[model samples]
Target: MTTQLLSRWKRSAIGSQLCLDLRSPQAYQIRHVAPSTNIPWQQLSLRCAELPPKNVPFAVIEPSDQKPDTCSQWLIERGWQCPYVFREDDDTFWTAVEQYSQPTTPKPWLLFRPCPFLMQHINWIEKQTQQHRCLDIGCGSGRDVAWLLSRQPLWNVYALDSLKGAVERTHQLTKNMGVHDRLVECLQAKITSEGKWKTFDEDSPAVTAKNNTTATAGTSPTSGTTTTINNTIAITNGDIDDKSRRFSPGVSTDTFFQDKLGCSQFDLILTIRFLVRSLLPQLPQLLAVGGYLVISHFVEDGVHEYEQPRKDHRLQLGELAALYGSMANIEIVVDVIEQIEDGRPVNSVVIKRTGP
Candidate 1:
């Protein structure tokens, strides 16, 4: 393999390219290239968010003596531009591997940052050094929750998500950080406006990875007909008995909060990249007086079309400002469509509950 790219990267400025060593920790510790962060290939999905934004180019070092094609493709699918994946036996690169050590200081990009809107008003958060409660709705992968816990020692975080994988990931992240005790609970829940509720049969066999049979049943809860999960169901994070404990996917947000969360109030409630319009009206009730509501999600931009999030999932331009600005109890602090680091536009709003 050619060392032209590797040599150029080595000679370039410090921040020119991020070198990711997708190797086992044991192998990397013994001998690894300079300026590379060791993120094992198996854990890539979980750790990818900690890497630099997708726009930054990467040079991947494959695990063992394996080819880099698969690892490179994974990055590409996630909007990353990986220019090179170093071969294990590349003599030129391997010769200088142990010469340099990984940097002692944490790279800015590797740090899990909260949303920009929150950082902009970090002074407000810092002021609340005393005990406070924060709720993270749709806490996917738990980065934001983990960041909040790490940011303030006295603050307790309650994270809620619909997916089992999300809850497990959040738990794992918090546990790994040694802040799991402060994380009140990462509840697996779906917030909805529909009134229908159903119970899954606990007696049913847990779906095995190999079998991959989806559970479908007669009498659809929504339409009073039949419904089915067509493809393979990937719900291995929890057991079949755990299925019985889940709230019906159609329970209203208000109902779930009351029943599951004990109608608790929060000093800060964050809903990032997840939108449920019906849940907006209940925010004032759930938030304590003087609490802040931070919402950052994709908005309907006239110029672009997105496949996920759908049209209804996004807020119309100035929708949040218009709605919250008129609320007598809520004060619109910041309402604007900001282009984030990756160039996607998100309507970030920070509102405070001024009255009970």
Candidate 2:
């Protein structure tokens, strides 16, 4: 299709329904049309199943080196309606869209900074194989998730948190950074007990369903929201028991996390600033052979003063390492207690699974 025609179509209401950017995540990062869901050309075949229904009209923004006809033909064969493909060289399309600009300086928020320990060991991480999958447990606001996505073509991050607001914030950060292509998934879940995780579905009857609200799937990532493809299953009905502070369940929570993760093993699993001792035993099972586990959390040192004196939440010296002492086929890369510039003493451990 001609650039002018595509541009005019994009302005129409129908065009707003589905606009895809069929460029590499790297290319999309450099420049892409706003509101377009980015699914890299290389991943199109693998992810096409997640696209909107066949009846929905969609358009694709192809790279300069790719043939528009070839891409459209591939999609057509896979049940996608004839998709409008616009080449990168189309000046009219490029001139009509707004390009994202990178910030000249770092922001002051600590939430935006990558953990010092992660940064220090990034060289070791890069030396491993490509296309690694990482899971961030208790991923508040998803600082680490954003960092992993920034290392695109290398890592696919899955972030989880119990707070709905935190999960939503992570989605916003991923959208703002234009790295939705690298984020595997972000879920609202809680690791409440050993080997048991629960996920909250807002569309459940106890929440939006009772109101007769219909939930739509295949939402644009840039729309500042994230949702699952399956809306059928939900952990809770939104009824919270006051004494226990837990939501009333509508379904079993046993396999909810695994179902959402879509994998039993991950290349890396990170838990930062949040500690759950119950999850320690399952770390070995979650990590693939040669996979790494990085965890960092606050420690109770008499020298440091705290606003809240919750000793149970603070780790004792060498306590973090002791939890993994019985785990087999793992090598400890780094285990130490260090005080950051902020005066918080943290126990950080980086271990690698060496056996199947």
> In terms of TM-score, which candidate is strongest?
1
Across 96-154, the per-residue lDDT of candidate 2 in tens digits comes to: 55432123222111112467798798778767745488988988767778777777356
Tens-digit per-residue lDDT, 1-356, candidate 1: 45566666656664344677788879877776555667788888877655655666767777755565788888888788777667665677676544444554432223345676877875775574244788998898888887777763466889887666678889987775567898987776654443222223335554333443434444343333211222312242434444333233455555666666664688889999988787776777778888888899998888766666788888899888878888888988778888877566889888888887
The C-alpha stretches of model 1 lying farther than 4 A from their native spots are 1-19, 29-37, 45-51, 68-70, 84-114, 152-155, 176-178, 194-259, 301-303, 340-344
Worst 10 residues of 2 by lDDT: 235-244
Question: What would the TM-scores of all predictions be?
Answer: 0.71, 0.57
lDDT of each: 0.68, 0.66
Q: What are the RMSDs of all candidates, in order? A: 6.6, 15.7
Question: What lDDT does candidate 1 reach at residue 182?
Answer: 86
lDDT of 2 at 249: 44
Model 1, residue 318: C-alpha shift (Å): 3.0
